[model samples]
Target: MSIRAIIADDESLMRSGLRLLLGAADDIEIIAEAAHGAEAIDLARELGPDLILMDIRMPVMNGLEATRTLMAQASHPEVLILTAFGTDEFVYQALRSGAAGYILKDTPPDELIHAVRAAANGTRTLSPSAVESLLGRGTTSATGLAGGGDGGAGPLGAGNPHTPDPLEPLTAREREIAEAVAQGMTNAQVARSLFVSTATVKTHLARIFYKLDVSTRVQLALLVNERR
Candidate 1:
């Protein structure tokens, strides 16, 4: 099935550019566009698209606020934040808001499309620069941001001496999947490497996320990096 998506951005040119780029993908269909977060939320309710390509820093409601609102619902489209800002604050906030993925506008066209598709399929996506920002800051930097700090009690609680080893619960297969994901492999990539179906890989990933208590792929990668 083709993935239905909405492009939410304040700039007309940016939305147009995104439409042009995403339109080229055979499996992705652009259903509508929104100028701000509020409109995006309304359209999401009305259209029920599979994915929402959101932008931060809008006029009335910013993307982060919109993301938090949409995700709060029992059922909502996956939100993939596509923005120019890659600052640590924006990146952290977007992830915390339950964005399915975060990527800078400068991301390559191919990678951006992949991110949208992956997010639509319930996979976490993060641009290389975003991943770099998380890694550069180290896992502890997210302690306060992720509501950690009580000796490793949050999504990014790795590296805390008092925290039980997060990786302890993973079965060998789960560990392999986690490592592959941390290495930036998509679900499809991990599936191929493990000689399993994509659905199987996704199932493992879900379990991995629960066992590790991490929400975003960036957090999982950070924990894996800290381990290594």
Candidate 2:
């Protein structure tokens, strides 16, 4: 079955251009389009697309609010932000709002298509570098640990604020998987890159998530990018 998608952008030309570009992907089908955030919400409930290409700025309601609202649903589609703003604040806000991924509007066509495919499988669209470029090197939690509420200290076992953060507890294999995911590779992509099965990739991701204390791939990307 094809991955259903809804394009939500205020500009008609932009929507048309995206429709043309996404048309090339065999597994993606454009089931609906919206000019604003509220309309996107309506369509999401009505069509239940697999993905939503969301814009930050829109009339009626903004994409951030809409994303939060839609995510509150029992069966929500993955939301991917497609916007010109790549600021760290915007990226953080979008991720916190439950967006699956954040990609700049200037991304190459090939990458954009790949991101859509990846997002269809619940993969994050932002590269680690892209996440870093947009936001500060900080953890999502108040404790500065990638995992929220966990006061993580480095291998040195020193809790002093001045002590360097302990190395993340990832095995060599898990590290490899995190690196690939930080680069915005999907589980299938990571599996192919590592010559492993998708099931194996998922297993590693679970371990990585527990080790890093991040629930989402975007936060994992941010954590890994900070180390680079």
Candidate 3:
């Protein structure tokens, strides 16, 4: 099936260019485009695309806030953050905001397309330029974003214990998977690194999500990275 997508940015030219490039992909379809974050949310609710290309610094609302809110609501789409700044802080914040992946705005067409496909498939990837910023970091260098977005409506907060230990519930194997994911490894890479099947990796991730009380991969990464 074709991967349905939405492009959310303030720049008309950026949106136009992305529309042209993504439109060329035979298996991809651009169902909607938004000029700012708030519109992105409304469009996401109406269209329910499989993926969203979110840009930071838009008027009315910013991508970070939009991503946080979208993942909090029902029918939330996977968010792939595209931003001008690839600093460590931005990467860490985006992941914590429940973005499925982070990529630089100026990334090459091929890699951008690949990132979109990966996000649709529940995988995380970084723009090559953004990779160096996070290379040696074992955990988040700053505070994590607001809670929820992973499971349900502010789900992590409602019943979570005061001073809750996010990783306390995970098994040794599940911890390994969470660490791999936090380090920005895709499922295929994690499987190869562990000498396991891709299916095994997904199985472990599901358990990790349940145990960690996160609804998405991005939130799980945030939890693991928070340990750092």
Candidate 4:
């Protein structure tokens, strides 16, 4: 079946260009397009697309907020964040926004198509530029994930209380949702970003909270940031 998708970007020309490119692919289908985050959320809820190509910057609401709200729902879709900024903060924030992947706005057409397919098939794809940022550009940086300070480690294999637990237990989607909530996305925003309903993001949050033994969004955010 063709992968149904929505393009959520504030730029009309960009959206139109993407639509044209994806339209030629037999395995993909453009179900909708939105010029802003709010419209993207509304249209996704209405169309029920399988994937969303979300732009990080937009009017009315940003992609991060939208992704957060979308992921809070009960039946959210996969989100692939696209942004012009490849800064560490932006890339990290996007990953934490429940996006299945992150890609630069200037990504090659073929790679973007591959990312859509990957997201639809339950695989996460990070833009090469974003990955480079995550790994740090040069040596002499902190080696541990999310850094080792601030009690950032979870109870991982080392039996150390500070070590982060193995992330293998959680589904990719759940992990993504947890990360997004950690980045401070609202349920509505997650729902829109993931192309799912608000109730779905809430369900995911409940499960994540239980697993993390946290009671509120604030606690969850702290935990994820500490152990991310």
> Quick one: best TM-score, which candidate?
3
Clashes (N, CA, C under 3 Å) per candidate: 0, 4, 2, 34
Task: List model 4 lDDT by residue over 117-201, tens digit each.
Answer: 8777644566666656755632111222221112222322223367766444567888887766544455776788799999998
What ranges in model 3 sit over 4 Å off? 136-165, 171-173, 180-204
TM-score per model over all chains: 0.68, 0.65, 0.76, 0.65
lDDT per residue (tens digit) for residues 28-121 in model 1: 9999999999999999999999999999999999999999899778779999999999887788778767787888999899989988998897
| For every candidate, C-alpha RMSD to the true structure in Å | 7.2, 7.9, 7.6, 10.7
Q: What does candidate 3's lDDT look like per residue over 155-208, in tens digits?
A: 122223465667888889888888776655668888998999999999999898
Q: Which stretches of candidate 1 lie over 4 Å from their true place?
A: 140-228
User: How does model 1 score by TM-score?
Assistant: 0.68
Query: Which 10-residue window in model 4 sums to the lowest lDDT?
Result: 139-148
**Candidate 3, 107: how far from true, in Å?**
1.0
- Comparing 3 and 4 on TM-score, the stronger one: 3
Report lDDT (Cα) of residue 183, candidate 2: 56
Q: Which consecutive 10 residues in model 3 have the weakest lDDT in total?
A: 146-155
Give candidate 2's whole-model lDDT: 0.75
lDDT of 2 by residue, 1-228 (tens): 898999999999999999989977899999989999999999999988999999999999999999989877767999989998877678777876777777888888998898888777775557444446453534332222221111222221214456454335888898888767655566777888899999999888888877866656766755665554
Ranking by lDDT: 1, 3, 2, 4
The per-model lDDT (C-alpha) reads 0.80, 0.75, 0.78, 0.71
Question: After superposition on all CA atoms, how large is the RMSD of candidate 3?
Answer: 7.6
Best by lDDT: 1
Model 1 lDDT, full chain set = 0.80
